[model samples]
Target: MQSLLRWGTERGAKHSCLQVMQDNAPALRLYEKLGYKEVYSYWYRIRPMST
Candidate 1:
């Protein structure tokens, strides 16, 4: 992932980000260790549009 990101960054990407569910502990840890920081968070709720 780091290699991929570095390649993208070198190719002119300003930044890269990925979304993970709040319950994804392992992924969050890995991302943190790789220099990613929590820049924003969002919440979601879903329901059927029709019965």
Candidate 2:
């Protein structure tokens, strides 16, 4: 992840974002360590299928 961020910065990338589940503790820790923060929250909704 760090390598990819660095690569993007080298190419003049200004910002980045990612999606992760709120309950994913491990990933949350890793992203926090890498300087990521929770800017906003969201969710997805799907319609039920009829048989």
Candidate 3:
């Protein structure tokens, strides 16, 4: 992950963003440890397919 961020920065990226599931505790912890902060929260819903 850090390598990818560095790659983007080398290509002139000013910032980076990541999306993780709300229930993903491990990933959340990792990102937070890496200096990421919670900007906002959102919920997604899926519709069932009709037979």
Candidate 4:
């Protein structure tokens, strides 16, 4: 991940972003450790399922 970000920076990239599920604990922790922060929230609409 660091390498990828560095590569982008080398090419003049200004910012980076990614999406992860709210319930993803481990990934969230890792990203936080890497200096990421929550910028926004979103939801996915789904149809009701028949029982």
Candidate 5:
């Protein structure tokens, strides 16, 4: 992941973005260890239609 971010920066990327589920504590920890911070968060909602 770090290598990919570096490659993107080399190609002119100013920032890197990624998404992980709120329940994914391990992955979140990894990203945080790599200098990533949470900028925003969101959730999905769904409904069923009557037949």
Candidate 6:
């Protein structure tokens, strides 16, 4: 991700964002190690609609 961040920065990307499943431990650890912080949380839900 460091490399990607560098690429993005070089391409004029002021900030970079990524998406990862909440339960992905290794990915979380790697991001943290690379200085990425948890700015917020996300979730998805399903619902049935009936008329």
lDDT of every model, 2 decimals = 0.90, 0.96, 0.91, 0.93, 0.92, 0.86
What C-alpha lDDT does candidate 2 achieve relative to the native structure? 0.96
State the displacement of the C-alpha of residue 42, model 1, in Å, after optimal TM-score superposition. 1.3
Question: What are the clash counts of all predictions, listed in order?
Answer: 0, 0, 0, 0, 0, 0
**Tens-digit lDDT track for model 1 on 1-49?**
9889989989999988989888999999999998888889988889869
Using lDDT, give the best candidate's number.
2
The regions of model 1 sitting more than 4 angstroms off are: 48-51
What TM-score fits each model? 0.74, 0.86, 0.82, 0.83, 0.83, 0.77
lDDT of 3 by residue, 1-51 (tens): 899989998999998888999999999999999899989987888899999
- Stretch of 10 with least lDDT, candidate 1: 42-51
Badly placed stretches (over 4 Å) of model 2 are: none
lDDT of 3: 0.91
Residue-level lDDT tens digits of model 4 in 1-51: 889999999999989998999999999998898799999997899999999
TM-score winner among the candidates?
2
lDDT, candidate 4, at 25: 97
What tens-digit string does per-residue lDDT give for candidate 6 at 1-51? 778898989999997777889899999999888878889888988787888
Ordered by lDDT, highest first, the candidates read 2, 4, 5, 3, 1, 6
Lowest summed lDDT window (length 10), candidate 4? 27-36
The alpha-carbon RMSD values of the candidates against the true structure, listed in the order shown, are 1.9, 1.2, 1.8, 1.7, 1.4, 2.3
- Please identify model 5 stretches exceeding 4 Å from their true place: 49-51
